[model samples]
Target: MTGAPRIALITGATQGLGLALAEGLAQRLAPDDTVYLTGRDLDRVNHAVESLPGGGARVRGELLDVADPHAAGRLAGRLAARHGGVDVVFGNAVMRVGPDDDPREIVTEYAEVNNFGTTRLLRAFAPLLRDGGRLVVVASSLGTLHYLAPILHDRFDGATSLDEVDAQVAAWRDAVADGSARGGPWPGFVNIPSKIGQVAAVRAFARERRGHDLAHGVLVAAVCPGMMNTPTSAEWWDVRGAPGPAEAAVPLLDLALGPVDPLHYGRLVRNGKVLPWSPYRDDSA
Candidate 1:
């Protein structure tokens, strides 16, 4: 709190992957660096921040629920006002439609939080980010590819063509319209394509905003994080089912807080490297 430290703001830092990532940064940050841990539960977030590596990492706790009804923009604005500029902001909370929820309700709420919530968070902080500042989002590989379910949970990838996924979405709408939306999880194949579409939208959002000569360019990429055992999945961490579930956080941290390069902007990356997806830098791919 003395010297102006480098700042990183992370949502969903109360537990699981978010906590792990925060810990990693705490271990590495210099005295002047501050980590802003945000979440819906104040007590939980405070505990998480307190429990972090206390060596000298100046940890600050901020409470925010990105999925709260119409609150994301306001929340982001508050962060911008408080910090002046965030060196890194990681959007990582999640809301998914599942068998326990109405299918239509699920998609609507999920999109609101995952897509719209993420967009608003970034836009709110655009002014607060220094030139060359970074933004990282926690996305599932399911948000990119149609992988088989591990008998523990379900998810979708959003990297494929929107047309194909749109067909499924239309069908889901039809089913829900007739009051026949099935109770089972949406098929993996169907979900992956839809998720990819969402990711694509995020990328486009970055592109449109790039026209402005903002501080440090934005690297708005989502990651799979490989279904680790976290609250989002109800703490279901069967290695066979949620294999490498928390493994993606380290790479996610790197993508957000590590050095920036000209090649990785708006790219969907994992494992400390930007994937060749979306032709982010592959001109002829």
Candidate 2:
């Protein structure tokens, strides 16, 4: 609040990993630091902030539904005006519908909430980060393991420029809308490609940021929190050997708060360690 001890923003903070990360960050914040917890429901956001251990005086709540680009843009403007800029931004909001939903619907919703939502947040908040600040997105390992289309996968894996990645995501979105983004192993499982798209975005952002001559430095990357056991992930927890949200939040907080390292830029991480971007598949069922 006084000097720049660092300010953090986390979306989807009403529950699950987002709330857990808020709690962890609150515990680690200096007296001058602040962390904003956000969600679609204002009451739930306030409750989450109040529920933190000792009711973290430095933690506050706000209404933020990353699904809405206009809302995201407005929030970014407000934060910039109030705090000058933020030190860290965590694009953590995501949506996973019933496992039996139609593939088309799932693809559309996931793209809206998981992929495009993150892009909106980044575009809005990336400039607000202090030169040496960090931007982390809560991504998934499923992204690396799954492919929406083999051709798209090749382009994503071998992208020579960020524009190429952006174009590919656009193409995939168009395909999804046209009912051509089907027949993949992750059909009706939108979380996979959604996260994969996020990973690519991370890479693109990192490259674009590093290429520019800026004041300090900005490290942007995504972290796979593993398969967290929460309401959204209820269907696969038992079979995936998922950990509790609190347990999963540790690595995410670590990455968000850790010092900047060049190697970490554009990498997909788990438990504070960088994970190789590979397309290894698990065909067993």
Candidate 3:
């Protein structure tokens, strides 16, 4: 609380987990710290900010549609001019499709937001990270290697650049379009690969920052907050008794604002632990 004021940004923060994250940060950060809660809708964004504790004094609302292709960069540029640099960023915007959704449609929609938008956010905000800043991509356990076919394991695990990860995503889209992806190799749940691409992007980005000269060095990771009983989750699965967004925000806030761990860098983390990249590992625990 005695350190310099911090600047944090949370995408898709109008509601659900993103909103909860914004609220948690607003409450935990120093009084002077600024937390930007962003969403595609200007009205909702404003409403979300106005609803936070402290009369939303430290929280600001911004319009951000991750799918816009240029929105992230624009926001980052404006933030850079005002704050010089950012301390933490949560790439929390995403799109989810249900089981009954068309495979081709799912690929198109998820790629725009969940997959490509993730890469866009990283590319724009990463350079603005302060010395010890953290960039967290809100991925899921379904993104783990174990959920993907063995054929794709090496491709995702060995990817060292965003372009490489993108190639895999493009391939999946093509497979879905041609009707060859209907069976085993890829999971029936199309969203799995989108999340995989997200985690892969995090690992790839982390590797790129290996030798940078920063105070504590920047930490980037893909985090799975687990299932929450939010409207988004309720849309796909029966999360009747699942934890709420506020409960799920605890670990995410810890990972973002707590001490930085080099081991957690560039890895998939959940509940404060790093998830294995190997598909064969028993990750159920």
> What are the C-alpha RMSDs, in order, of all predicted structures?
6.4, 4.3, 2.5
- List, residue by residue over 72-112, the lDDT tens digit for candidate 3: 99999999999888998999998767657888766776788
Give the runs in model 2 whose Cα sits over 4 Å from its true position. Answer: 1-3, 55-57, 145-149, 158-167, 183-188, 211-217, 237-241, 279-285
**Residue-wise C-alpha lDDT for candidate 1, range 171-275, written one tens digit per residue:** 544554445545544442234534554555445555655555333355555555665654446533344455343465776766666666545566566675555
Deviating ranges (above 4 Å) for candidate 3:
55-57, 213-215, 280-285
Question: Residue 237: error of model 2 in Å?
Answer: 4.2
Per-candidate TM-scores read 0.72, 0.86, 0.92
Comparing 1 and 3 on TM-score, the stronger one: 3
The per-residue C-alpha lDDT of model 2 at residue 76 equals 87
In candidate 3, residue 194 scores what lDDT?
Answer: 85
Specify the highest-lDDT model's number: 3
Candidate 2 — worst ten consecutive residues by lDDT sum? 276-285
List per-prediction Cα lDDT, in the order shown.
0.60, 0.75, 0.85
TM-score of 3: 0.92
Query: Which model, 1 or 2, shows the larger TM-score?
Result: 2
Model 1: residue 114 alpha-carbon error in angstroms: 2.0
